[model samples]
Target: MTLVEGSGCFVVTDEGVRLMDLVGGIAVNALGHCHPEVVEAASAQMRRLLHTSNLYYTTPQVELAEALVASAFPGRVFWCNSGAEANEAAIKVARKWGRLHRRGAFTVVTLEGAFHGRTLATLAATGNAHYSDPFRPLPEGFRQVPRGDLAAVERALVDPDRPGVAVLAEPIQGESGVNPLGTEYLVGLRELCDRHRALLILDEVQTGMGRTGTMWAHQAAGIVPDLMTAAKGLGGGLPLGAVLVSKTADCLEPGDHGSTFGGNPVACAAGLAAISVITRDRLFNRAAIAGDQLKEGILGFRAMGLPVADVRGSGLLLGIGLSEPWARELAGVALQEGLLINPIGAATIRLAPPLVISDDEIELALEGLRSSLVRVMRDKGL
Candidate 1:
C-alpha cells in the first residue's frame, strides 16, 4: 500500500484508504505518526541547526543523551543512525572490553532466533542462516545458543576452546515472532554474564521506548545490562539509534568509533520530544493496560475457535499464533478489512501499535481482525 500520511493510530494511503496501523512502523512509532510535539521539535531544530560533525556539539544531542541516561541505567551514549549501527557499536564495545578485561575473549554468545540487525557484524551476531547465508564469510567471533536455555548459555560462555566475552540478546525477540525470553531467563543471563565476566547486551531496538510496558523491557527483568542498544522508537519516527554503555563496560577510547549523521540535531530533538511525551503522559503504563485489553480481545478469537492458537509477548509487542500456517493470508485479509498488521513467517501475526492507541481504537482493531480471521478461515475451507 502507498501510505501518504499518518496521524495517531491510523494512516492514509495515496488511494484514500485509511487503515488502523497496528504495526506502528514496525515498532518505531511509539507516539504514533506526526505527533505534534515531535513534529514541532524536529521542525524547530531543523530551522535552528540541521547538522554539525562530531567535532561540534548540539543541545538536542546532549539533551537526548542525558534523557536516555537518566531514564535507563547510568551510561555513556554513542549515537547512530539505525539499530544495526547501535548493535555494531555494542559489538565493538564488547570486543574492546574483552581485550582489556577478559584476556582477549572476543566471542559473543547470542540466542538462537534473535534478530540483532542487518549489518555484516550484527548479522554475524544474529547467527541466523536465512539472513547470513547468502553473505558468506560473515564476521566471526560469535556463537549461537538455544533461546531460554541457561545451561547451554553457560556451556558456551565457559567453553575453554573459545572464551565468550558477551551474551547478546533481545529482551523480546520481535522478528522471530515476538517471543519473550521471560524474566527468569533474563535474570539467568545476567547472572551468567556476571559469573563469566562477560558483558550482558540487551538489544531493545523493537522493545524499547515504552513498547513493552516499560522504557526498556529489561527493566522489568530487574537485571542491569552492561550495554544496551536502542533504535526502533528512539528517534520518534526519525532515524536515531544509540548504544548505552554502563560505566563498568565503558571501554571505548578516542577514535574507537564514530558516525557522521548519527545524532543529527533534528532527529535528537524529535527523540527528546518523543521521550518527554512518553514520560509525562506515562504511556508505558498505558501500553501495559492497552496491551492486556488487546491480548484479551485476541484471545477471545481463540475462545471462538477462529484459528488463533496463542497470543505471545507482553505489552504492545504481541504475536498472534495461528493453528494453521495462514498468517500471510490472514494479513492480506486484514488489509482488506482496513487494518495493518505484520505477519512473521507463516504462523504468527505481529502487532505493535502505537502507545497512544485508545480503547476505542483497540476495539476497532479487534473488530477488523476478527472479521479478517473469519474471512480467511472460510476462504481456506477450514
Candidate 2:
C-alpha cells in the first residue's frame, strides 16, 4: 500500500510493481497521480502559508470556495478534511434546521445501499448492518429506505411519528458498487423533499468533480439539492472536502461546527489546481466520451463468451459485473497481470479511472480485464 513514487496514470509500489492506476486512488486522483499543476500549486502554497485555521482569511480557501459555488452550486460552503466530515457538517445543519423549524423533528432518511462515510453519524446513516453492527448504540435520528423508492421514503418520513428533516443519498452508490439512480428517480426525490418541506442532500463524495460527466451528478437530473457534499477528486490526491449549502438549507450558525485543518491553504491550493485542470482541459467532456467508450468495450466482451454480466455507472465510474461471485478472484488475476481494480461486494469490479486516461490506456485496461476474466471463467468452469 506504500506507493513511494508515481507519475501520470501509473504508480510504483513499495515492492516496485508499477501498475496502471485504474482506481485513481479510489477516485481522489481525478487529475491523475502527481499531476504537475497540483504539485506546483501545493508546493507554492506550502511555501507561502501552511495552516491558518478558519480564524483568519486566506486566498486559497476563499478562492476554492468561490470556484466551487460559481461552477456548480450557488451557496455557502463549509470546508472539511474528507467525505466523512463533509457529510457530518451537512447532517448537523439538517438537524439544526429541523429542531428550529419542524417542531423538533430531527430524523434524516438515507438510501439502503448508499455508502455515506465511516464516521459514527454517517455510519448510522449508512443502511448496511455489517458496517454499523460492530459499533452499537450509534447516533440516533437516522433511518434507511430502499434506493429509488419514493413511496418507501414517504412512509419512512412519518412512520415513526416524526417529521423528516432531510433525505440524503448518493446519485450513484460507489462502495456498494456503481449503482446509479436514474435522472427520473433523482428528480422525484427532489420533488418529494420539497413536497414534504424536507431538505435533499446529495452525497457527491464519489461522483462529483466531473466523475459523472458533469460538474455535479445531481445536474443530470436537472434539479438542485438543498445541500450537497463533495470530496475524493476535489483534493487532487490530497485531503480536502466541501459541504455546499443552498440558501434554503444554510442553517448552520457560527461556532456550530469547525475543523482545525479543514480549510488548510495547501490543501485548498491543490484543490483549486485540480478544479482548474479539470475545467481548462475539458476533462468533464473527456470523462463522458471515454466512459462511454470503455463501457461499450467492456460490454463487447460478451461476444467472446466472457463473464461480464453487466456494466453500470455514469461517466468514468463503472462497475463490471459478473454473474457469479468471482469478482475478487478476477481482481487478483488482474493485479498479477499488472492492472489494478477494486472488487466490491460479491460480483462487482469497480473502475473509477482518472478523467485524463487516454484511449490507449483504456485499451490496456480492457485487455488486462479480458484476460483476467478468461482465466477466472475457465478455472471456475463457469
Winning candidate number (lDDT): 1
Candidate 1: where is the Cα deviation over 4 Å? none
Question: Candidate 2's residue-wise lDDT over 250-270, tens digit each?
Answer: 878889999999978999999
Candidate RMSDs in Å, in order, are: 0.7, 1.1
Q: Let me know the TM-score candidate 1 reaches against the reference structure.
A: 0.99
| Candidate 2 segments exceeding 4 Å error | none
State every prediction's TM-score relative to the real structure: 0.99, 0.98
- In terms of TM-score, how similar is model 2 to the real structure? 0.98
Q: Per-residue lDDT tens digits of candidate 1, residues 1-382?
A: 6999999999999999999999999999999999999999999999999999887889999999999998899989999999999999999999999889989999999999999999999899888899999998999899999997899999999999998999999999999998999999999999999998999999999999998998899999998999999998999999999999999999998789999999989999999999999999999999999999999999999878899999999999999999999999999999999999999999999999999999999999999999999999899787
